[model samples]
Target: MFYLTSGVLFLLVALSAPAYAEQNLLEGGLLLTAAALSVMALALILTLRSLARRNAKLSRQKQSFQRLLAETPGIIAILDKNLLLINASSSLKSLVTEQDHSTLAIPVPLFADANGSIDLLPEIRQQLKQQGIWHGEVWLKNEHHCEAFKISVHNLSSHQGKTSTYILFGQNITKFRQLAAHQQQQQLRDDTTLLPNQLLFIEQVRQAIASCDEHYPSAALLILDFVVASQSEREVRLNEQQILDIATNLKLLVPETLLLARFQHNIFSILVPPHLCKQYNTIFLNQLAHKLIAGFNQVDSQGMRSPLRIYIGISISPNDGDNVDLLLNSALKAANRASEQSDSALCFADSANQQQAPDFLAMEAELYRSAAHGEFDLYFQPKFSISSNRIVGFEALLRWPSPKRGMLPPPTFMPLVEETGLIINLDRLVFRKACQQVSYWQQTGLMRGRLALNISIQHFTQRDFLRYLQDTLTEFELAASLFELELPESIFNHPTIWLRERLHSLERLGFKLILDNFGDGISSITQLRLFPLHGVKLAPALVKYIEQQEQQRNICATLIRLIGYMELDVTATNIETEMQAYLLHVMGCDCQQGHRFSRAVPAEDIGQLLLKENQLLNNQRQLAN
Candidate 1:
């Protein structure tokens, strides 16, 4: 308002002065001077107002910076060229002692050395001077504990382009470090027994082997196979308590200084150091094995005699093997040989026999390479309908033609495949091949029947199994009805609710489900009724002697009748002779698949077989007419 008034008055005086100039020159000059002074006064007022506004803006920016430093999550501090504390964030105050705060230097709590000396500060400063930045992890002393901080220090330059101050940034990494340590520990432990797992055990073995010298030239590896004696050769399932009890017993028998680990579900391993091996001889090992067997022979908590049998296999380093994998494998091979013996419960790896044993590692490597190169072939065995005397379908079997071995059957490689969890990949490969063959047959009109695929229980129960089936079918432009999934009878071992739902999902997708290898295991009629099965395939062993033995024949006939009464399509497998086929047909088994009809042939040979069958059918029709 004052500036406005002055400007108005100056303008009015200037206008009036021009008129008075002619009358009184002196009076007009004075008026002009007064107008000039008023103009200067207005300019000064405007400059002051502009300066005031700029000062207010700087004030607000300073307040905002102080607030940011106080509220920040991490530690932030500023130090002068002499390393005296110039400013610190609220977080930094928590780590600084009262006496240190009074000194105004870098806080002592930030140093992790024994005497609370800032030994790292000189190095940090040197790095900042050379590179303008330094970053590292440092341990900081908190109130009751030490915390890890990832610290970053930057050189702040002045207007003269010289380092004038330092800016320190710290992020607390205590929780992250703890979490990483926990995860590393978890990787070395077994989830069930809480013992060091295979990875850790292998590392320990490697270390022990490397530590061996002339004084202690050998280490001992013992593999204990805990087998439950039963009527059948099927795998024995032991509950968690039983497994723990077995582990506890082994621990008591063995010394605490030795390393023990669970190699597999029913297999445990012990590693004796080289010094111990030098102290104990073969006789000592034999006595220890006997002690383990005798200790487990006593009755159980239920007051019944324990059926657990212990087979301990011993392998010595520098004799059986010199490395971790070789030694472990030698022990495993010895354990397998011991399990086959009926009288003895222990076996030592003999160097002579070791030469004849198969190199499982080489076989495993070859199998993996073959699978990668698609060296596997599928052989289709035709399933004949006995009643109609026509081809109903074909069961697809996987065959590996190894370059070393002439032809390897499923039994030779499948156990290893399943053990290594490679069965999932093989199962997918088989499914795709079967779908492609079926699609080709449909396109050429060569044959018309469903193709049965034997799926492993692990692969069949996968969460993506149904989706994979749908995708493969869609890719081949084939219907699900053209495919049949032959699941093993062991699939019934899973929870009934989950198994039923999974089977029903497959059924809903239009694929037929057949229980494969029926009567191979101890499957009951009650378990059979719980599944949504379209058919059942008799295990070859169940009907192997049906032709000669009357008792076996009666049992086969009864099983066929019982299955027929259940309204299921029964297929008898491995029909090697005409008598077996005839017997099965007369016994109400309409479907038969075995060597008697046709051996498993390649996909290309299938077309010729179908053509021959068609020609035979045409000739029969003409004879009937």
Candidate 2:
């Protein structure tokens, strides 16, 4: 009877919805007795309660599963055979919130290999199919940026049920990678300056040498050592801060193409690429070293100052030596020699050329003896007016005719003279000789233009330089206006109020000052802006390539125009070709000097050039008339 009641209840529930009955079933007496109806109703109530209990248990289980996924830091998902997301962890919502969780399809091409490969997902899936698992790293891009993840994939299938799926887990390792990079940087960088340490510096040199080619012929290494004076308590603290400040300044000053390192305390090294090494001469590098020294002695952020000195030693690859140890030793030796001189603090490593290398003691002795005996002769290089093609003046150059060696250029022996502190004596002799020669020329009616003289900064910085200039001019009975003092732009590297006052004193004495090699130093325009000057001489190499390069021509033209507007005289040197001369003339350059007019001649030969220039002026005047 119980089974019959349960079956009757089941049939009624199933067929009642489609039954087209006019009367109510409970009211009808033909199909049921009172007891049978009661049994069917009881069975229906029991079935409904069981269904509600099962649903409640399933809802609670789902909530617990979601809570676990939400707390997890990584991503977990199940995918079908077509790589459609069957279910995803709550953590994935942070990356793609608007994605349809019920059916999310990600193509294989969407995943990029973290190792910079083009495709990774297709191969990973194939490996999973064969090996039942795959593990690797990949990159995923969302709306903002890409992130790296370590991914693990597992293949799952049931023998009884033919359903198959993949289990995927992803762990974010971006911070771990960054920590590794930070540790590596700490190992390779200096603690104080944050520049590359000595070991890394040597490694860079080795790599540069290994990569050298015909097109890239050489690389240069410059090691700078500083001489710091005794400092007070406040200055000592500032000194520590200065290291970091100077490092930051140098990084900004040097181009990205070069490598700068802090080899040791107060000693920095720079690696010059082949192109720059070939382009810049030793003199320019010396100017760079001086600029850095000036920077070193500057007041720190706390306004505390210290006395500092810098010397630089240079070595070039395939010339000084190709090996790292040899280069380091050679540069350090040169630096040691440089630290003893005032005229210059830059030295090149000794080369293998025996003819050029002389014993230091013997050379110093010879230089001192030669200075005492006045063995130096002056050579003159004539300057000419650009538009008129007339000789304007001559620059007196010093030449040493050594008795032991044939005529030696300044580069061959100036450092030795400077080291012996005999350069000041040499300068005095040159000054007196130049004044006497100019006086003689004027007396003989051989020359009429001003005479230009070259004076080293070491000599010019003397305490009584002004008094010596006055005395020299009086002794020769020559007026100050007839002489133009040619000072290199490098003099302005050490900016000081005292230096400015000295320059003003010279100008007050009626001497015409000319800034020589105007564009060679780091502070060319800044020098011009800071001080009063009579004239500017453009760098010779810069003028040489003006016509060949349009960019160079434009730069020259712009500079010339700006200087002309300042009402200052402009002179361009190394005008070798007629095209260069014509271009300068068109650009309104005031004067020029080059082989086009004449090479540097002797004092006696100057009369001939003056005579020729006078005749040319006469011809032009006659033609104009």
Candidate 3:
């Protein structure tokens, strides 16, 4: 450094002395070189400073990353091509067999065969061996631990000039399994009381299948359902949970061999072994169904009146699916189809391919269009007082002039519409048409009695069905009293606030409200305090089955005795034979409807009947006076 500085000073002195005694080019060149060297030295100093600052920044980043890796609690691991773990976080130590030096290896095997189908496991293992990367859930077994984890593995190139290695990140999700078992407990309701729940009796069903080690043993899944016609929010909330509970109780009674779960609000899924189904003895299945239906009548431990329903579907496996998800899905589809068809229950093995059952989308479409376009017509059968033979009222029974089919009765498709939410529109049309016909009858001086229309409570409870009724009544220019809205005993269900308000409003406007098919369903009469009803129509089932089913006849007798004290008028529908009419008259039934007097007739037939009756009554009165 001293020599360089001395050269610079000497050159400067020569240049100033005009070295060689002249202003020569050599002096000029020496001074120029000195000036250039000073600028180059300054540039070199700045470059070195920049490099040092960059190195310091990089070192800090490396330290920060190292600290993060050491502090993270989740399972962070690296494995070789063989899937043998090389590195993992300390928290994952318990997941592995501890080594002498003490480190962790998060094993992957606890998630194996979780859904009972793992054909992909072996294939994944082979790919991971070859590629050094894989991602999925796997079951890992240790002496004391078994758990599930979501894992992701990556084949990473080595930074330290070594062979590439695998890095994995996993976090045990044991809680997830527990939650899965519990989620549906809240989603679905019991069929009877409609409680929130489903603990699919898996162990019982699995054991049953195992017990039948010899025969054509297989498990079947059943789904059951119920549809309420009320659309009031108050009714829905009150019923939703109890409905789930009812479904739960229903699932419980289908035999230990059947794993029953409340899969939907109105549906129950039952898993049963094929051979355990009693060797084609359908009566056994029907017995089981009856038992479930009966069980729904029990007052829950909470003493909440559980007015529940039971609809079931069964799907047997190997026949349905080899895996749980598929089997469960198939069973659900079959159950849905059964509800649509109003079948006692359905089997997944025999249902339509599109569903676990043929959703009969065709039937549903046909019914929907027919109902929506008012292709279906109503026929009013006179509901007359037996004692006075007075034409007090008429029950408007819906009749579908199906495009491809003849007149379809209520049992044929009312259920489908109710389940599909199409009944709301259908009911509206029925109301308007019935009212229009009644008005026409009045104009002909043939109609002096009120018209009764059945209201699907589900329409009032689950959907925004109020508009339809309000609009139809306005369009027909019919007084509320001119029409009597009929409903099931279920309408008296708990939490009747909204239902009461709507019914009372309509009642005050002069329309009468009636309960049809009242015997047995909707056990709670408390809702009646809120309902402004004019009468109850004994369900046709009660009357039609009376002679055939002793139990049904007795129930009808009891209802006839009790309902009157409540001051509600009674109408007997489906009084087929003269004998049935005598029984109804003996029971003091006020009015009757059935083939005994006349079948449901069109507007023209009713008009003529009403006109003739009026003329006859006038003549009788004149003669008596």
Candidate 4:
């Protein structure tokens, strides 16, 4: 405004004094030039002030960009067009040496070749030029250790569309690689003993077989099955401490170079390379087997040797059919055969033994067909009251009189039946049959007592067992009081709540529940009292030598007394001798059933026995009169 005001006043003075201007034109021109110079000076000052403000703003932005580059956790760098390092983030410094910080071009270690022969920089540059970007993993080695980085590089273009510089970004992936490797290793190892699991073991076996040749003709696979023996008929399981001790002992006996793995519960496998058995394969394996057996004979707290048995089975490659599955199956079959024999604890795979092996598939199929067609019969064994010498009840026994294999007993096929999960079906059949027989006997007006049927634990614990029992009895038009369910002592092994509820349900239905084979398993008095049991049958083993062995007699007497005190009826089974029955009767057990009275017979024979007992009672009454 000052310059403009001065210009306007000067113009007005010059216009008003034209005659004076003509007289002093040189002086007026110099005055006009001075005014123009002043205006130009003021414009120069305003432009300088605006430039100063813009420079200050640019400086603040430059500082912020520098701060972000310095503090960034990821690696960042800027390289000139010639690939010389212009700037880099602070995180990049840790991955490089001091010399790398001072150097202009990218560090040599970033593109180091694994074989120290190839250079990767040319390839990277080519990719960046063609695609405008490059990405891959790179390994960098410092003084302390090596590190892995996943890096990406891009071409920074100028305003004229030409490549100006290169921008690089990287992430450290060393820890991630390590964690993935650790997880893979864990997946291939057993959690309990930290040994290679079955999956890894099979891989090793396959590798061994693939590497075999004529020079190395045979490799050995040994399957060691460990068993703990107890006097009781129930299964004995090894505790954690016992398992650890066995593993430790086996490790000491075997060489560390061989692979040892836990194959299954109570089973261990050892892989012996062909080189170890090149000269004396049999001698070496036999020695190893003996050593394993001796190691297991550890002394217990009572200073007595432990009852641990080790069965070793050996199968050689190429001779035992070659592949992983074939070798494993052959070894298992050998181990099973070793277990069956009493004299030998070790066996080799052979064709004869393999032929003798039971075909479980065929047996399982036969069981399914038998259950579907109702091709089974029940035999009744009369239980007599020792005091009155009269028939009280009959225990129903399952018998399969096959046309191909006649007179097959329960022990012959029941185990397979249970294993194939067909026991439930068979039990249901027996129950329905028992109900029908009792109903018929009642309709004919024959004197029939409570009929006992052995019920499987799996069958009895079924959710619909009670309902089925009620429905079946209702169909037969019979009362539940005519039936008795004999359960094994193993029934107590189930959840207490479930077992109690099932037993209570049966009791509520007016049926009697008897614990069979009471003294043969891990049964306690507490279990006996916990459930609603009407009686318990003594195991046949306990009554086998009660007449000859005084110790056996005393044990039975004590058990009978204990059961009698609990207000539960005691029945003795397997009484084959007259002396056995007399002794049991003297011990206060009034009910007995065994071959001494009669072997299991058909329903018609049972009717005759009942009639004979009634006639004897009548004659005795007449004699007393």
Please tell me which predicted candidate would have the highest TM-score against the true structure: 4
Error of 3 at 357 (Å): 6.2
* Each model's Cα RMSD: 22.2, 15.1, 22.9, 20.4
Q: How many backbone clashes does candidate 2 have?
A: 0
Q: For residues 557-590, what per-residue lDDT tens digits would candidate 1 score against the true structure?
A: 8888888888887889999999998888888887
Residue-level lDDT tens digits of model 4 in 1-625: 5555665666667667767575475466567667778878878998998888888988989787678767787778787765557777766755554544533455535654333345556777777777778889876565654767788888878442276688888887878888987898788876666777788888888888888887677778889998887867334897777777778887888879889987887888999886665533554565566567667767888899777878878888888858999999989888888888742277779654334233434555677888899888999998999887878888999988665677788987787677557899999999988887787778776645799999998897788889999999989888888888899887877899988988898899999999999888888777889899999999999999887899999998999999988999889888899999999999999999999988898877766777787898899999999
Candidate 1: C-alpha RMSD to true structure equals 22.2
Better of 1 and 3 by TM-score: 1
How displaced is residue 34 in candidate 2, in Å? 87
Scanning candidate 2 in windows of ten residues, the lowest lDDT window is 351-360
Provide the TM-score for each candidate, comma-separated.
0.48, 0.48, 0.46, 0.50
Clashes by residue pair, model 4: none
Ranked by lDDT from best down, the candidates are: 1, 4, 2, 3
Computed on alpha carbons, the lDDT of every model, listed in order, comes to 0.79, 0.75, 0.64, 0.79
Per-residue accuracy of model 2 over 517-601 as CA lDDT, tens digit each: 8766654555676787888888886687887799989988998888887778888887798899889889988688888888888
